[model samples]
Target: MPWILAPRRHRVAAGVAAVLLAACTSVPLPPERPAPVEEVRPTVPHPPAANAVERARSRWVPVDWTELPGWNDDRIAEVWPALRASCGRPAPGWAEVCARAMLEPPADDGTARAWLARWLQPWRVEAPDGQVDGLATGYFEPLVEAVRQPRGEFRVPLYGPPAPGTMAKPGWTRQQFDTLPAAKAALRGREIAWVADPLDALLLQVQGSGRLALTEADGSRRLVRLAFAGHNEQPYKSVGRWLVERGELTLDTASWPAIRAWARRNPQRVQEMLWANPRVVFFREEPLPDPSIGPRGAQGVPLVPGRSIAVDAGSIPYGTPVWLDTTEPLSATPLRRLVVAQDTGSAIVGAVRADYFWGWGADAEAQAGRMKQPLRLWALWPRGARPQ
Candidate 1:
């Protein structure tokens, strides 16, 4: 986890926005029904953590089912896949529940809720100081164009990791890779694909993985998936924050669009913009087994959009079933639901803090960009199970 600074952080351009059901191709999904307008709550940040040990950062407060917001409102069926995925690699204290789940899985919302209630207990997540509210952000899969060879517009190379111990100790920084002869030699023949926009390439590195829409020499298009291979081990710095610190953009205005616009206006500084984050990620090509499945997460399973969440793995393990209470992206309407701890991120570093996976495509991008709100979480632990 090189502070990718993954699978969730990079935001792509809207023109290429669409989900790839498979690695090399996909069919356009039907338009989704428009969401009804609803009142939304304002996003607020939680209090800063005091200097305390990891144990004191979060505490579980036992609560009944009724305590969860919108406990029964979610289409629990959507959650079943993510949870079932977790069954393959259950976190500590989750084996029994996951085994039970595998033996007799739920088929519908009613059945799913009933099943969860019978076997799992909802424990409200909070800090030792009883601070429940925490920061809630959004992340999405960026679909972009690429080429197999470095021809014309596709010049920037997306790389695979060099052999272990290739670079001295922690390896070279992102800025040093292209200029250093040794670094270039080490990365020789490591390209998985090439893309036109350097920003798009950087986004893929930042996001850890993405769908690459390719332009074949035969004048045909193909899509492929790039999974995280490794990183340079350099520290990740936020380019957005870097710009903000230099008074180029405000916190509210430092998004993908804004960042790119600023880059275009100042072309000479584009390299500087990129070099701001020294943590360069490498990628590997992966096969698409199931069209319906997305990329694997920290939980060692596919993630479910709107149902999969990235949390601080220190507080919640990868396979924990959590009931999250938050607002819809860019809306105050409560977006409470059952989510699986399928992934982790560098920035996601608190007990109640979460990064909501908005899935793939245009709709997901729209939602993920504007989503920074307050959140509360309740981990659904196995009945009679306690933290050891």
Candidate 2:
């Protein structure tokens, strides 16, 4: 999470363009039939397929179902919830396809695979330079115990945005918010809750959203979600990268646990480490009606653990099903699967990069912290539908 910026913002690149999928690592279909031409709504015009490869932020090369690595092995039914959730707010070219998805909820793996094959076309995602290889990182919601007000060891405050008429265009940096009297006064009454650890607050901010187990004044407990509301609008910096540059840690050893261990060893410098990243994210508290539901992503849909991915909006539109070809973190175990581009991150740019959402809790934190791996992608667009 420290490596990626907030997942709340949508930062699509300007001037939408399409790139071609690299042929080097792909299994091409026979030339007898060309890839199906995507049909988009008249409002979102598409360049002719012939010229697609020549210009664009990213490109797509249609590949056969067999070309997607481990396409047949995934437990397709596991993706149903995420798929259905995406349909709640279908992308521009997905209304018809989403309608079918909602009407025919596949009950099993085989059925799901067949349904996808019938309605979607898998297109390899590539950079304009035809580069297919990219990086895949991981992020997750951090669940932390908290109190309604600051008390005992719970001193760090989690804030909501300042009132509409009280804030400036660009807000204060983390350092200023902590030390400047004027900046601190601006946020005096905006604290939504308080927590004991600064790192936990940092985690929630970095992930852009998380679940908080709140302890009320009456001693009753309720779980709530703190979703990304707004930010200071300052640039985000990576604390992990900061430690690596300072020789306190190496790139390979700069995981979240490692960072925390370093913080414990140098308690006096914890504030310094936190200040490395000037960005501070504010939150809006929402009721956790269902524990199974994750925080809403930039797409405005609840994310599904292991089934939701944050991608570059310019590279793959939100709600698009993606065939991710990547190995497990720090190992060679194959982790290919079908996921929806239900979210996006500031650092999740380029044609092939993605941030996999691992969900909430301890195990999720561990997995996400270590998940920087090589990746390749295939976007499954609705048949006869083009990228918007």
Candidate 3:
């Protein structure tokens, strides 16, 4: 397969926030607590700083390396590729550090951790109100089976954008696209491929980009990417939240998988369920070059599963190494690791909110769909290069 160039847009799960936030309702979050230090390392503390520096959306409080929870226990070498990936599109004031990183790739976890400690300092990200904790959610790239031309059960179409001037400014709702002649006429002949299930199409659109295992008309199969092209501009509504509100599912059980199960049981109402969300996303087809490489994030670099995260660029710039202290999806097991800020999202607004990118496949989808945990982060920055 050949790699094709495609525009990278914000790859947020359209209604993830609404579903996750609804799940967290009525439950007060526990106060921030640092993980117990398991490894003892001699360290020199920096001289006291004057105070926390305020950014546009958050405050950065300089902190000692030891203050970062579970920092010593992480396999720092695991994140080296992601670190180098960030260096490809280094953020402001990162040229010097990126240059050094390119030349001094570490040999082991110990060396990586040491090299990072020597080159960078850790800053705790907090809200302006001095709160150090926030919510963590998850997103993933969906994989949907498709065909070049509609055949057999493959009736639902994945469309590209409408003719330039045909799209309404705030375009037709999802229902309007299905029922109204003007809306249907506008999108006619824009089909990129066809799939068996409408839910699969929605999954691809919700995540903004996905893989299509396409069987071309010649009967040969190849994987391709369908990148987000544009949207209807209609307001997004959470189908998961809709089910929760109507007593079909509880907050805890309102995951993507659960939603699909509900749709199966109530097949006749599947379209009704989909209509609950007003937005419809269009896509452009792209060639898949390397099966190992993930989709390009907003940073214009391929994402690394388990190592890439979407953050508010204002809170933490793209290419910054972030120490994430959070838990596994729907589990209390601590999941503290080093990840990079390489993407952003519409719902991912605030000082501490994050969307963990769980790559592609069934397990990734499962984790992303259920991951709504509390979070704390420390950005590892080149010494004296902290954004003001």
Candidate 4:
């Protein structure tokens, strides 16, 4: 497979103010608590102070570069791919910056850093309650085993959406995966691939995309990536929170590993847990060009392992350069870096909300599944663009 050069057109909407609608829905959210501090990042190394906190509106507060922790140390050049990808479809107020960036690549790390400082301004987003810190999580492309068709150990089917008008409604609930005749009939001949573990199927759907190792009849294996296509258009419910609410698991013990362990122990209750989230995501298979690059995010660009982030589309438009200030999943070590808002998720909402894109494999999964940390974001907008 070859690395694809695809253009991502970011459709911009009104700024972070629109995310208030999330409160009306049942999106799974972490408890509100002050962020645990294990690392205190140094502020701008050479700060003469060029920015300040402006008035607050719907939780977005304009702050100067001096306030962005670790802003001066970020390897802005490393995220060029992420920047270039969004340049293909630069959003409102971003065309000039994206255009300048595409005209020539940065000369060096220092030059890249200079370019960002010269052309962009940073704005710190806060929550509605005037809190600068908010929840953050991690998402990644899962690696799993699958077959071209149903085989000995592969019985579960991962499907694409039924043809237009084939579905009984615009969307199908989780129960429709097996119950609804239209839903079952619609996917009869549309199996993307047959994965061995039902748990893998559940996670792929939740994560919205992944890569699969396909075993041919002769035993040769090849890796193919699954990208999000469409969904059953149903609302999402969190099984973890459901378990917590039902007294089946405590909030402290609701990590993915724990959930899977419980699933194994109570196989009979697995279906009940699986269907707790009525949202059923569909996928489209694509070529996996390189092991290093991740799948294209909602911004329509390939994600850069540790430098890409998924954010609430309402809170932060795709293609916006963000000075991410957060901690590593468990260690609380500073994970500060420059990341692009290239993706979005159902569970991702609010002004300062983000979901860090952590590449793939067991290590990535472990990090992603355990991540739920305090987050603060600084959107680096083009200096010459309209105020965000």
TM-score: which candidate is best? 3
| Best of the candidates, lDDT | 3
Model 2 clashing residue pairs (backbone): 17-56, 18-56, 19-58, 19-59, 20-59, 39-384
Q: Rank the candidates by lDDT, best first.
A: 3, 2, 1, 4
Q: Which lDDT tens digits does candidate 4 get at residues 330-358?
A: 78699898888877655555667777777
The positional error of residue 117 in candidate 3, measured at the CA in angstroms, is 0.2
Badly placed stretches (over 4 Å) of model 3 are 1-49
lDDT (Cα, tens digit) per residue for candidate 1, span 305-364:
777787777777777888988887556799888888867766666677777777667676
Name the 10 consecutive residues with the lowest summed lDDT in model 1. Answer: 29-38
Report, for every candidate in turn, its global Cα lDDT versus the true structure: 0.68, 0.73, 0.74, 0.66
Model 3 per-residue lDDT tens digits across residues 69-132? 8888998887777778778777878889988887898999899999999999899888766777
Better of 1 and 4 by TM-score: 1
Pairs clashing within candidate 1: 6-207, 7-207, 40-332, 40-333, 41-332
**lDDT pick, better of 1 and 2:** 2
Q: TM-score: which is higher, 2 or 4?
A: 2
TM-score winner, 1 or 2: 2
Off by over 4 Å in 4: 1-60, 170-172, 179-183
| Candidate 2 residue-wise lDDT, 204-315, digit = tens | 8777777899998788999998877778878777777778779998855777788889989999999999999888888879897767766666776666778888777788
TM-score of each: 0.84, 0.86, 0.87, 0.81
Q: What residue runs in model 1 are displaced by over 4 Å at the alpha carbon?
A: 1-56, 217-220
Look at candidate 3 and give me any clashing residue pairs. none
For each of the candidates, give the backbone clash count. Answer: 5, 6, 0, 1
